[model samples]
Target: MKGSALTFVLGAQEKTCYYIFADKPNSNVGYYFAVQSGGSFDIDYTIKAPDGSIIVNEAKQRQGDWVFIAEKVGEYEFCFANGMSTFAEKVVDFEIKLDDDFKAELPKAPDQPIAVEGMQHSVDRIEAKLNDLIKSLQYYKTRNNRNQSTVKSTERRIFQFSLFDVLLMAGMAGLQIAVVQLFFKDSRKQLV
Candidate 1:
């Protein structure tokens, strides 16, 4: 049923109830969602089951949205990475819309099989969600970087102006001193 790793619902109004129908539904199903490399320029990332569950546990040098259907529901996990750097400053956004509310409807032994169009829809949903997420990431990252850069530049300019003011004050004081000294010396010579 679930053909893709993820799905995104844009302004999914209040509650139409969208859920990922897993391909291999079982009693032990653990789901996961995480960003690949966080907010880094070029960071390889690997994710493991956050709670040590094997739903998705491994160290990898890759990046992207990954979805895993495990053996259970409650043990789902999530993680992110920034392998390009060891700064641990990466911030990846992820979500888990877990549900145990709907069980697959089984046909009676005498009934014909239901042609539930789930897989196709799942793929479409995942793709749309992934694309949306990527776009949102780009938007937010650009905004954040620009804001920070602007703040930094403003701070630098303020510091430079401050230094200039100090230098100008020093120059004016020195000139005033020289002018006063010259006036005194000339006055004394004239008086003599």
Candidate 2:
């Protein structure tokens, strides 16, 4: 299987979609996705067939994985919607895989002098290990991205709060000075 992965931002109250074309019917396809950042780490996802029929639909989900066979030869629409967020944009990571015939090109062990049933076992084990490593790397990358976004958001809020605090203090100081000046003038008038 060969696939491509991408990370994208979905604007608030917007829909982001991609189309996949299956050249033939009954082709195997797999998909996985996750919300890396934004409100509650959640978003709505949908998969629609060429005929405009909904194949899969999920709401407020953080992650999902699925595999299916294409029923028709055409374009399929996959989408992520940030409608639930009024101001926060979402960062989403997704991957799509289509079954290919690359495995058929692997060198067979039949030409060896001593052919054993378990000869290909080592190769399979190594492949499995590599896949696991890739998954772990991807997971950490997503976590790092989410943390950065949180830091930026917190910094902005703190700046705004500090600005408000400074303005309030200045206003209070001006009011105090005005009251003292008024008290001194009243005392002078009484003395005169």
Candidate 3:
């Protein structure tokens, strides 16, 4: 199994593409992406096979996980587009995995006992579970990043709104005071 993971900032109205070569046919290709911040946490993505055929197309997606078999041996294109966002840039996290359909066998020792074989099997199972746990941790980390971004955005908006509200209230109070003073001045002039 071969894989690459990346985190990049996609500028507004820009598109970026990456190529992954599949040396073996019928290999399992996995793609995963998440929008960590900016512009509703969404992006457009496309996966094209080496033959220029679109395997997956998505628009304004926040996150996605896709696994497909590569029937041809060639380069696959993965693209992320932020064209929908006119001004907001986006932070994206993505992973690509190429796994061949071959399981490695542990070399057997001539003097190896049955217990050692069982122990190897148990070790393989443990390794598989550990991989799963790692994947889960990565997913949670992504979610945490996105959630933190959302929280900061909301906090900024609230602060700005509160400031505006305070300014408006102050203006209204001053206007009321001026009106009351003018009313009293006009009444005194009439009495005189």
Candidate achieving the largest lDDT:
3
lDDT, model 1, position 107: 42
Q: Please provide TM-scores, in order, for all candidate models, with all chains considered together.
A: 0.38, 0.75, 0.90
- When sorted by TM-score, best at the front, the candidate numbers are 3, 2, 1
Ranking by lDDT: 3, 2, 1
* Candidate 2 C-alpha lDDT tens digits along 102-177: 4533455656724443556666778879977977777787778778878998999999999999999999999999
Candidate 2: deviation at residue 8, Å?
Answer: 3.6
- Residue 72 of candidate 1: its Cα lDDT? 38
Which regions of candidate 1 fall more than 4 Å away from where they truly are?
A: 1-115, 118-123
User: Taking the tens digit of each residue's C-alpha lDDT, what string does model 1 give over 1-192?
Assistant: 222244322121111122333333353333333333323333232323334534433443222344444443333334333444544343333344433335454344444333344544566688779968965775565457546756777899999999999999999999999999999999999988
Q: On residues 11-120, what C-alpha lDDT tens digit does candidate 3 reach at each position? A: 99999999899999999998888888888889999999999999999999998887899989999999999999999999998999999966676777779767678878
Clashing pairs in 3: none
Query: Which prediction has more favorable TM-score, 1 or 2?
Result: 2
**What lDDT does the true structure give each of the candidates?**
0.45, 0.83, 0.91
The best candidate in terms of TM-score: 3
Candidate 3 local accuracy as lDDT? 0.91
